[model samples]
Target chain A: MNLPQPLQELIDQFESLPGIGRKSAAKLAFYLLNVPQDRLNRFSQALTDLKVKTHKCDRCFNLTENKRCSLCEDEGRDQSLLCVVEEVTDLLVIEQTRKFNGLYHVLYGRIDPLNNLGPEEILAPQLLSRLVKEGGKIKEIILATNPNMEGETTAMYLKSKLEELRTKKSLDFKISRLAYGLPMGASLEYADYGTLIQALDHRNGF
Target chain B: MNLPQPLQELIDQFESLPGIGRKSAAKLAFYLLNVPQDRLNRFSQALTDLKVKTHKCDRCFNLTENKRCSLCEDEGRDQSLLCVVEEVTDLLVIEQTRKFNGLYHVLYGRIDPLNNLGPEEILAPQLLSRLVKEGGKIKEIILATNPNMEGETTAMYLKSKLEELRTKKSLDFKISRLAYGLPMGASLEYADYGTLIQALDHRNGF
Candidate 1:
């Protein structure tokens, strides 16, 4: 109850975050107590620069400090393939799979009407313009949003929008969604009903 | 893959703390991006002051910014009783119980032999000096260390040390340990064997 002011404030700030609880907040505040003043200053500087120095990439809406993100500037990656992800972290997850070697479009968030979030709230227009401006370069657009309800809605909306662009400009690029199936190492008995239905509906001969 | 410098640094710092992993680190970094610049400044200031402003209280070794912690300075608290704990956070946990009205002596850490931590590494000497200074005023000493092996070892060591001090000063005070029992709402089948044995050994009148 008589915790020092700054320590208590730090704990309060930590508690305000998404997953941190009261015990963890206290642990972190006390753990930070042992860190030297110089390290604390560096941490503070990092926090200050976290918001001040970072901005969304103009082209891809990915996090970056420059006019464009590194992925967009890198000429080594495949330019004809574009992966659309719900957030920059999803792009990171895709990158970790080491299977996708193309550019990315970060939507920043998905459309969820129940949560009062609409197309205008996110980076939907940026994605539209990027598609329009770079139509000739991109050959395939992969919709990699989450497989949940909101993600399905966003994917459908983007699919229609991409379809309209393709028809209007007669773009040669293909619009595709990630396939549904039981994940690797998953058992069939425990698989969700909708996923199993999708897998059955889209089954292919080996 | 293309995270900016400051955001990456903050993520790395967050990852270095206990219990935080890579995914949570990135989530925290990106979440901090949405926090306003003024709020970020306050959070940064709190980090700056966490170590710089806090030090161990000279009397009880509880964390404080002043000469003595508020608990030690409070005249309303029972001055005749003192609770010895392994760390300041342990004292906080006991405070949450709202059953203890005595002062506390924080040893700062348990005797973790596997981690190369011993009595000398923590505030054991400070506790000894405090006991010597205030032995006449204190009538009861409670060893409130954890119930695990290391905690039991630390409490035994402290008990012997306190017994030596009591013999040297001919101190007239009682030393006690917390009662062993089945905790409220704990299932008998789920209780560990050692705890169950201790409960049986310390069984009192029904």
Candidate 2:
């Protein structure tokens, strides 16, 4: 026999999520059947509030509940050095490292030509306008997008645009992309070919 | 900076689910952020209805929206044969095989001494009462519980109780257990010692 309507609907919703299969979805639905009513209600409330209670930062496009994100509002952050990333999650990952004191610009996506995404599809225009508005105050713009092909394409596109703007508008910010090499603690035996080549080309002086 | 409150709560809820880690929870929460408002609402509604709109089948303990589950209400099924399982999920698994037309009894859980669960903690008493109610109608009782320790304990306990009831009430049902052997597609080299021993003990005629 088929599952009850409510259970079936919940299973279908769970299956629609990334990486969850039909069996896993049904398992989750079954597990939730025994959860306390209040906890289930809280989970449902959180789902409803996830989109309703949050908005994007006006300046950087990072997620926020207020007019601007905490990173954007903090005056202690280094405004002169901005890091541009492809998504809010990437910004959060960098923030967790506690190494970056500068503000961030969330591009929302990368330049994926295979999927019909271009520079225009991302927040490239917004980044340029923001830079133009900031003028000479920002000394450096870090392209911290992912290190894949689409990320490389986005960084290259942004770099050329920033260089053209530097000459045309007399901007003073230097553009830089994230360094490429073997990840820390990763063995050379397992490292991919592209990473090995990049490591050799960008070898640090002893 | 930490995630927004609503997003963080959703992530925490996702993390509480079995097999979902912190990173996967965050990924699911972020993925849902982009889901359409209507879909999100539907997902939220489903979660609310999962518990509120469904209940245990009065006769068999399987999950159902109505008083009696479809399995119990069906007149075409073989009421004389009853298969006792540990959970509703197991009943569904057996039903998916489509080999059994018999009615089912869900024990809800198994006896586990490590967890302090006894025969009374499960639906053993309920099963006895149901057998008494059915009396001589049920011709055979299949112990279809899992082959694990707790399942074995539950089945053993139920068998003794059924034997006592059969003597007292003069019920004519014969009790039986599912066979133990190698699973269909499992290789002999990889099969565990217990399975190999069981397969040897229960060798079938060619």
| Residue B99 displacement (Å), model 1 | 1.9
- The residue ranges of model 1 lying beyond 4 angstroms of the native Cα positions read B111-118, B187-190
Top of the candidates by DockQ: 2
Q: What is the DockQ of candidate 2?
A: 0.83
Residue A47 of model 1 has an lDDT of 92
Worst 10 residues of 2 chain A by lDDT: A170-179
Residue pairs with colliding backbones in model 1 are none
DockQ values per model: 0.71, 0.83
TM-score of each: 0.91, 0.96
Model 1 lDDT per residue over A1-206, tens place: 47977789999989988899988998999898887788889988999888778888888888888878888899999999999999988998898888988999999899999999998977878877887887688999999999999999999999998889888987888989899888889899999999899889999999
> Local error of candidate 1 at B136, Å?
1.9
